[model samples]
Target: MKDIKAIAMYLPQFHRIPENDQWWGKGFTEWTAAKAAEKLFQGHYQPREPLNDNYYDLMQKKTMEEQADLALKYGLDGFCFYHYYFKNGRRVLEKPAENLLKWNDINMPFCFCWDNTSWARSWSKLGSKLTWFDKEKERVYDGNGVLLEQKYGREKEWEEHFNYLLPFFQDDRYIKVDNKPVFLIYRTDEMACFTEMIDYWRKLAKIENLEGIFILGVNSCNEKIGMDGILFSGPSAYWNPIISSNHIEYENRNGIKCFDYETIWKNVMIAGSKKNVKTYFGGFVDYDDTPRRGSQGVAFINTSVEIFEEYLYKLACKNLSQNNELLFINAFNEWGEGMYLEPDKKRKYAFLEAIKTVKEKLESVVQDDNEELTSALKANKGLSGNVEVINTNMEKQNGKFKEYYFLLHRWLQLKEENKNLSKYFMDHGYYRIAIYGLGVMGKHLIEELKNTEIRLLYAIDRNPQLIYPDFEIRSVDDDFPRTDAIVVTATFEYDVIWNELKKKVDYPIVSLAHVLNEM
Candidate 1:
């Protein structure tokens, strides 16, 4: 059961456009409030106004297309727009999410996470008033009367909330398990009666025939606040019963406890059975609630690309050897929280690379025998050998050696998989070839074989927006050359694409590894 897949949540505050612009503090065109709100709403519920100046600037700088690209690049299981409902109960998550869904229906997978929290002057309010006004606003909670928040729900009120949420619950993008839709409760403590609130929800879901489960975002200290939490298991949630905190302190956004993977994971397994629900894990990049909290802010965890990649790879390796059934990630595009895998101007693709590496490693591990650890190691043999051997060696390396090891490991994986389908020369007659989807591995393969005879057929991708040269390109559904063409693809969800291509062509489907070996 260790053969579990990973899922991630994407929160795109198109409203954040202005926020992004302001944070970056440059490169934004003048826009009116009405027009900005209309454009920002795009496919979701309409906003009363464009997000405040901070958010408006963010949206003005980055488009939805940019956001979608960032989600796919990270290999997320799915994405959910942060559908908001407030101010006389207005709702908007459908349009933009649907639009994103339409853009990349096949290759890029997605799902939704309902961010249900209050919108108040105290909650939404950031920084102090007065000349300190020059300072960025910091989100501060008074903790005076948490019970009085307008969004606080009695059991019946919670049911009413879900009633309004029924449309999204029926959609495929809504996360589900065992035929039940998953719903996360943003801040559970806000409920006046924590224990009674959950019991009521359980009763309501059964009565209404709705699949509802509330996931709480518990702060530090690890106290059992009585609601189920999204638990972390090492670097990934491959195994069940992840670590639990009696009370984990919440230090602004993204600033929380940093626990050790080995210690935490072992504890989680035993606790998981007692908890009765599957636990999850997440990897962190850098977190800066500074936008919401100013100079008296929380410390950010420095998860450089190198660290992020290694943490995920090792976590995947460990999970592939476990008995868990499902996994979850912190997020896909929560730019405000700063844990996004999206490509920033500074880190081109540091986060996306980690996601791809974890996915490839997991898939490669699954194709091998799982009963014993030996088969896993054996699967990492030379070229077509087992992946575990390479993983094992990589772990032993110190410091900078890790990067070179991964580069070669990735190279080997491509060469092997490519060899299978790309071997037109030795196996068939050494025919030339081309690959579609010039993503990370595709670009790497092209670089490795720059001097070889296998001419790349015009590289194509589903993203009509990608601009690359030296090859013909087309959408995944477009009719193209398939006769004797040694075709390879670089997108994830290969099974989906493989099935699609099988319907269109008679040629054998080859991988980049197969193509590289012959070269």
Candidate 2:
């Protein structure tokens, strides 16, 4: 069976924009709100902190590359960026997407979701006070009291919109379904001329010599709007009534709601079972928009890493049965909304690990089943001949399958053990270290070292041309730094690197696999 596609909803609001600077303050970004958040009630977690301990600017290409690496490591199929476009070709928070397009080496598949709602200045009293009022008092602006209105203009603007997205659709990395570029409309019902817009976009796509667009409606509004599929937003949208009843209400806090996180997960699973439409369910690590909403923030309380893992496993199984093979995560990094999957101070990469665990487990089961494997291979290659040979070989090798399973089990165990070994080395004064091979495994090892006291001296690679902004890549034959130790991160040529390094240097050498095996 094919692996389930997991697309995370990505927010590009981490960069500075002129509109945001004017509205908020100089150099203002999402972190401003996120850092300012305070606990609204007892036992309520607030002021969420990133594991990196720095507010990353999205303008940096390195940040985007690291994000892509993390997403791929966790088995995410792609990202659905929240594309913000207002009337008259106006756009905000577009640099990240543009940068992704420009830097071809990022290597992450991507699509767009037109957040077709009007931009409102509702998070603060200063922005919303002037535009919205009730009896001389400021009223809560419900996202529609727009500062910049969203207008669906005539054919010219529609053509312009399609033209703007044409380049992205043409990109090889763009995510598609059945040869059609996948686009999402966040608020399909809000646009009166959505049908016309869809038709125009589809017509434009055909003119560009492409198949029709796979336009999906977000939330429960897809039914009313004639979308090809529905992408559920999150649990809050589906179980609001249950949440409201079980939640805590605060005095003078604008009816801030708080619900048991586990209860929400249970309700979501129950609701998912009854769904019949072609839909993609969303899974969230946690949610608490108090940073943006302040006193009016709603949160799913008691949401631990373990709870999130369970929720993800259930959601993954549900998606597999639904046959959509797509599971949309609520967010990659909506830090202000407290729904991000990025590593945080409280739970560093725990959410990401949960995703990886579920995906690997599910995929492993499929691969281990001989019938499923044969079927998958036949379907993938459109093979009609000599499948018997493959099946015979699989059956003959069945007795040795236990060894393969054991190796797989050891590999998974080593992943965790290697992480602990990294910490041990750091604690024992292995601060200066050189990593061999600047591959995916090296990147993962680098991330592990970030939490420790280790300092990377150089990234050694066989190919000297391989460049990474995060570290200086040097050829293995280059002069070595007087390092405390050398850690080999190459899996394919581990023995080759180890033998070659042992010939040149007398420093304490350790391979990642060696450390894991020792543990």
Candidate 3:
């Protein structure tokens, strides 16, 4: 039932590479930048720490093993590792990936995104000026000097690079679409001899008796020649002045750039809206490079697990149903960029838990739809697939996705800003309660009540035949069990249900909506 693959972008820079050691200093890793970060202003969340202070080194094989376990455990399909290969087969930051390949025991599926940008020490050290967007538009990391240059030699160089990648590509764990290994490269227009290089790779792939590579452009839709697809990079794909109203604005007090997390996600939600067959969608867990760039960095403020799950769930339900392309999350462990899915101190595993929640719910919806479709086929005794009926059912499930978020958001908000349902029940002496109308809202109410001291007696429904293994169900026709109150979920027909239910049971009747809003 998984309609689209969820591949988290991975960073291998957690392990010390020789080039990084020489350029930055000895023992320098992503943890160095993340650990040294300090809050630049009030409300700034900095010095992102891994849970249990697990500042792990990727060089160890167990790191990869645990990472693979975490990813698979939390509904991620694979990892799209950032591959750093340059001209003349000169590569750096490859130890982790090498180990992943070398150690067959680690169960992880992965692909590559060639991060072709040149690196320099100056990108991190922004002196007194600290102005946002002064040089940011030119590149993500702006610096004067270049530590290494990315160049493209002729066919020979292309062949050499392809040769190095062959083993990983050939590995059974490499993700593929239609039997072709998926590859991503940034700035295809800027990658010299890009088309020629892709063509050469395809030729070489064919020689190895494998399908030609499926190369996707990284936020680049410029060329149509050699590229097979396009994977839009979140915020970057959605960034630009004319795109919309939400954009970079500097802090008046400190001249630092700050963005509303909601605003940018609103922009990102529009990505892949048109259902481009050759396009894949992308999203980020969160983006805050302040750990790496300090005040000179760009940050999206006020992000929480609830907000993230809402955005991701909405995006998944909207887009994944229409495309066959992989949905790439910005990163699994780019801690330096502040865009990792790895568990951290403040959030713990809430973000990862959110992924599991969304994935299971989506799959459940899909399974329901398929079962309904099968029932329709059997009833019709061979109709024309009942495609229209399937769409209608899907649309309803989509509405449920919207409803779940809306209610969850409002419920959470009420608990903090106003009187919550739990307090209402306790104040009213409804310690033991029964839910009337065991439908969507009733189920949501049941879940919300679990955090409180209220005890669920049972549920009342017209058709009590429905089986819910989690809780007991009772027929409204039967003598009601003793309870302090009955919370009705049928808000639209609350009056009618109340009149009928009151005649059957001696308990106060209240609408779930009234309880939530009256708070």
Candidate 4:
């Protein structure tokens, strides 16, 4: 099976710039807004803090090295940095990428995504605030007035833009598809003379003796716009129908809308399966832009680490099954937007662990299947002489025997693993424990522990509708019965459940796979 390349969108607004200093005050950066954010509603998590208070400055080269190491460790392919370029050779937030190019020791794959939208002052209260450094002196409010235009200039400007990117395209660490350097346009439809701009870039690449660019149009409603491919933004729009059907009233606090992350994820899975376009799907870890927009910030509630894992797993599997090898995450360190995968104070390394676990499990499935088949064949060969002859004939006459053997082998493996896991709990003095999933794995685990000394606390699942005759099914968000530890039974989402449990309880959480492997 071809390995999936997971690329995360990167934002470079963490470091200070001259334009920002003049507009927002001296030493101003994304951290300023993030630190000053207030909770707009009850249960709203605001002022998101990083793990170990690592409020890193992007200007420091060590910070970039640490980020690259963390991303590679978690199975990410690279980062598509959001590049900000405006009309007349103006650029903002270009220091990070420039610095990255200068540092040869930092080894990480990377690409670019042009944020082609015009910059405006809508980040604050829309109509109430005027842009601080508007050269035009336009007092227009509602944040729609352009502070900087994205005009498609003549040949000179186009050449300048392409020349600026030629070095990056030639770099060994740049990401490519079919030898073409991959680039993304944030909003293709919004750009003026889109086709001309792309043609110019391609011409420049050919002139430089490099492969042509593989440009993709992002958030284009799955439409082709003279680019190599399209990329679905995320659950933001795909789940609109489900959100509407639920009849949930979302209060537009300031300009921000509220929605449920679980609801969106469930719908996203359904939508993902129905997609017919050969496009890359993006996943959102958690979104609460309160740090940037405050009361006007959009937030997705009930976004536990478990939901994110399941969502990404299903999406990744879908992409692999469809033979598409690219998967884009919304962000790597979009702390201001609250969609970051970096370690945070409340859930350190949870998101990163989810990505690693899903990738490892999916990649191991085919190998495990082969191992099982080999063992079954060995066992069959060891049978009696008459039985071996009959089995061979049966395998030739009908393939059903092989299917039956595979099923039986899987059942026996699950039984043995569950038994070992139950013993592990007992050996560790964990008499009272809670199972964190209610799917097939959970059922097997419950059956294995039924006769053991381990007392079963209430079962926890994200689905509130799930029920069991012997025990009550409680939601992960609810206050459940206390236990010594939580055993995550869902094999595919073990890390996700463990991350969620760690935040809620202080017990030593364990996964079924870990227990079985140890035994």
Best by lDDT: 3
Candidate-wise lDDT, in order = 0.44, 0.69, 0.71, 0.69
Model 1, range 159-274, lDDT digits (tens) per residue?
66656666555666566655566555443322223344455566666776765654433221122234455444223222221223222323233333333333333332222221
lDDT-better candidate, 1 vs 3: 3
- The positional error of residue 362 in candidate 4, measured at the CA in angstroms, is 2.2
> Candidate 1: minimum summed lDDT over ten consecutive residues — where?
124-133
Query: Model 3 — TM-score against the truth?
Result: 0.65
RMSD of each: 27.6, 27.4, 26.3, 26.7
Off by over 4 Å in 2: 122-145, 222-226, 241-255, 272-277, 368-519
- Residue 254 lDDT (model 4): 47
| Model 4: ten consecutive residues of lowest lDDT | 124-133
Q: What is the clash count of model 2?
A: 0
lDDT by residue for model 3 over 441-486, one digit each (tens)?
8877887788689999889898879888767888988878789988
Model 1 score (lDDT)? 0.44
* Model 3, runs deviating above 4 Å: 121-144, 241-253, 272-277, 370-519
Which pairs of residues clash in candidate 4, taking residues 3 or more apart in a chain or in different chains? none
Encode model 2's per-residue lDDT on 1-519: one tens digit a residue.
556788898989898888765556666688878878877777777889999796899999999888999999988888999998888889888899999999999988999999876666553211232321112233333443446656666568989989999999999999998888999887553343455467668888898999989887776332432357777667665463321122333233335777677877765554432122366667777888778766556777778888888778666665655556578888899888888889999888989998888788778866675554444434423321223244234322542343234334545655644545565575446779988877666776787677667788888888999988777888977888778988886543443465577678877666654443333
Residue pairs with clashing backbones, model 3? none
Angstrom error at residue 305, model 2:
1.5
